[model samples]
Target: MNLETLKQGRNYCKSLTLNDRKILEEMLEDDFYIKFHELFRYMIDEDLKLEQEWFG
Candidate 1:
């Protein structure tokens, strides 16, 4: 959770290819998709709150 690590994760996500995304989409289907989406959404919300608290 430092800036460098977050930047690296962003870079890695940006590097994902179309095939990678398709594979990910296929993997996260149905009930699994709903659960994972919620978890991912929560992570993003928490990250936003942390950034606002620390940087703003």
Candidate 2:
């Protein structure tokens, strides 16, 4: 996604209830977090690469 989409996602997450955010944080502490972290990193790297290709 683009920067605007990422910002929207952040806003949506911020809009979540405190308890929901806490639960999400707890979920991120599990083994699945590693997989998700890796996936997110890869996606972000890809997005940056594409942006550079188009703009730079």
Identify the candidate with maximal TM-score: 2
Candidate 2 residue runs with Cα over 4 Å from true position: 1-14, 38-56
TM-score of predicted model 2? 0.34
Residue-level lDDT of model 1, residues 1-56, one tens digit each, is 45344444542333334565454456456566664554334344334212323332
Clashing pairs in 2: none
List residue ranges in candidate 1 displaced over 4 A: 1-8, 11-14, 30-56
For model 1, what is the error of residue 27's alpha carbon versus the real structure, in angstroms, after optimal superposition?
Answer: 0.7
Residues 1-56 of candidate 2: C-alpha lDDT, one tens digit per residue: 45444443442322344564455456557776665554344344433222233332
Give the Cα error of residue 32 in candidate 1, in Å.
6.4
The lDDT for every candidate, in the order shown, is 0.43, 0.44
